[model samples]
Target: MKKILALVLALALVLSCASALAAKVGVSMPTKDLQRWNQDGEYMEKLLTEAGFEAELQYASNDVPTQLNQVETMIDDGCEVIVIAAIEGSSLGAALDKAAEKGVKVIAYDRLLMDNANVDYYATFDNFKVGVVQGEFVEKALDLANAAGPFTFEFTAGDPGDNNAGFFFNGAMSVLKKYIDEGKIVVTSGQTEFADVATPTWKTDVAQKRAEDILTANYADGKKIDAWVCSNDSTALGVTNALEDNYDVDTLGWPIITGQDCDIANTKNMIAGKQSMSVFKDTRTLAAQVVKMVGQILAGETVDVNDEETYNNNVKVVPSFLCDPVFANAENYKTILIDSGYYTEDQLQ
Candidate 1:
């Protein structure tokens, strides 16, 4: 009996030592205010912990300086790897340089870290494809391919500081510019340039105000906006709010809006027919992929990357693993969101 007890205590000691020696990984999210970021951060932390790593998760509350400081703290805490979904792509150069000096591996998560030489790999959904899907949805809904009558359209892009915002805007523009040039689509607000239509921090209220101004100035003269191609769900929600509050439902009707992130509020909007479509990137899948990459990185194995050519972070092309995105509308939200166990019906309601 004493021998058995001694063996059990020895096993416990080994387990405790293993836990103490586990490699640490830091995950920095831009904000917890957004449901998507909350999901991403939680999922990643859970997965990393399950994989036997010390996961340090931090949310920067959408502040660049705060995010930088959080990352610095992670480095100082002896994190072997740091995964960052940057608040602003270009603002992390100093923090990332410190990470490099500490010989820590940095993975740009979802948001590409710009102008930094320390970013080792990028893991995100195909942002360009996200835009393409949005653009295609608008085209098919409006019958732009069949030369439908001239329609007034507007755009609402994400923060200019986000590298993915440019990719999203450009991808959508690639599909829509031909119609604009052919005179089939007109910019009602003349806010066609990305700079003009950008939402500063993907803030819903800011987007709402900008969208309100656009509707009041352009559509107030009895003109209708056929579509508003917003980059993500937050901006889409803003446009929806402005439309419902300002414009008469009978006169202007709801424009066919496009968005990404399949956020809960936007999913509710999609069900109510207030939102046309959203691109679902599935954070669970992304978190799993990132966790796998982290495991490989920790094991000193060659990390898997499918695309080595596309994402140039101004310093070098980041090795990227691009996940596919799917579009969700009212018709399939149940299947895509609920049935898939991403969300329960009660939660959405």
Candidate 2:
């Protein structure tokens, strides 16, 4: 009888220890307004929970102060790991300093947290490649290699505060700049600089307003925009909305617009022949990799990185694992998004 009691107590103690050791991980997202961030946060939470860890997910609604406060709260709540997709990459240095003081591990999720030594690892898709895919889509659709005349092109990039914005802009420009210089592509608005083309907050409404302004300034003379290389789906949606409202689609025809994130609305637009293509970064795959990385960190195993030199936060070079991104259009949305269970047909419809 004493032996049985002893065994019961021992089992209870083991269970308690296991519960205590289940480290809490905090995932901080920029905003829930964007479809991509919603998918990223939920996927990360689900994967972390399934991996025997506690997940604390927070959204900042595009506010930098709110994100910093949330990080402090997570730290107070005993989060051992903090994953942050910063609203502005450079705004989290002070908050991260506190996190580092507590010996908490930090992972920059999708968006690199810039100029902070507290960041331990970065997990993101190749942002430059995302732009390349967008540029290539335009090249193929316009038959730039074989076409005869010049095409009128415009650019729309993401928030200037976001570091990835530069990468996407540069990547697309790398492909299109030569054409622009050789007179194969022309920017009627003359808004070629990244600063001029940046859309604050990656807001669809801001992008729409900018598109309206661009159309008003450049196309009022009935000059048609042949292609619009928007950095992501939200911006693309804005451009599409502007064109649909301002231009006569029957005569002017829709431009070959590029986007990223494979957003459902944008995917549907692609299917309906409104938007041209979107760069699909599989958030599920990224979340799984991050979960695995967290597990390794907790287990005291070595974390792996494919990129050691590329991502510098102005303080130190962050070790990074860059996931590959692919472009999705009407032809392969079903195979890439639907068949892979990232979304269902009903969702896209």
Candidate 3:
């Protein structure tokens, strides 16, 4: 009896030691409203935990104050490092200031955290390349280089606050602008600027309403629009929903709608011939890289970064590791999304 009690106490001590030694990591996601974010948060938490870290993941429901409060709570909860996917890139300065005071390291995940020097590193896809892929998809689908007499084009971009939104719009514009200038493409409503076309919070309903207004004003004459460059799946979903409600597919036909994230619904739409293509930034790859980075940061090793000059966060240039992105359409989604195991064939169906 005495020996058994001693052994149990020894085991308890060992368990406590392991718990105390494990570094606590705080992951603050912007929202669970978007499926991609849900996946990102899940991946981050899982990978961090698997690497022997205590990971706390929180969703802010797209609320800035709630996210700020969550960050503060994590800091008080003894998190040594925090990963943030900001709802608004610039709104986290105050929260990060507190983190800096406590000597907490910050890794800006996916979205570039802006206007604050507290950010230690950035992990994201090549955002400009994401846009470029989107733009290139539009150019190729329309045969803009050759077959266009005059094609109707429009833009429904992402949140104005996300630093990535600018990169996405510019990359696509760089390809399509020449066509627009040559009169190969027409912006019927001329809502060409990012500021004008950006959806607040990347909200699908907002995008749908803006698209509806554009259709009501510009395409009411029954001439079909050829292409719409949407920055991500949420906006593309919005535009798709709006287009379906307002236009008749049998008579009007679907436009070449380009998006990012290859979201499940949008994938179904692609299979149904509604959406043209999407930029697939596999979150699994990014999550693994971020876990590697967190490991390096804790181990006092030099973290890996590929691009040191591209991402300037208003205050300083953030050292970043950029993962590459590729576009997926109906023809290649099976290979890129399914065979590679990012999604099951059943999930897509």
Candidate 1 accuracy as lDDT: 0.92
lDDT of 1 by residue, 88-187 (tens): 9999998999999999999999999999888999999999999999999999998999966798899999999899998899999999999999989999
Backbone clashes in model 1, listed as residue pairs: none
Q: How close is candidate 3 to the true structure, as a TM-score?
A: 0.94
Candidate 2 lDDT tens digits, 1-349: 9999999999999986586458899999999999999999998998888888999999998999999999999999999999999999999888899999999999999889998889999999999988988888898888897897599999999999898999999999988998999899999989999999999999999999999998987788788789999999999999999999877777988989999999989999999999989999999999999999988887788997899999998999999999999989999999999999989989987
How close is every model to the real structure, measured as TM-score?
0.94, 0.95, 0.94
Better of 2 and 3 by TM-score: 2
Runs in model 1 deviating more than 4 A are: 1-21
lDDT of each: 0.92, 0.92, 0.92
Candidate 3: C-alpha lDDT: 0.92
lDDT score at residue 8, model 2, on the 0-100 scale: 100
Candidate 1 TM-score to native: 0.94
lDDT minimum window of 10 residues, candidate 3 = 14-23
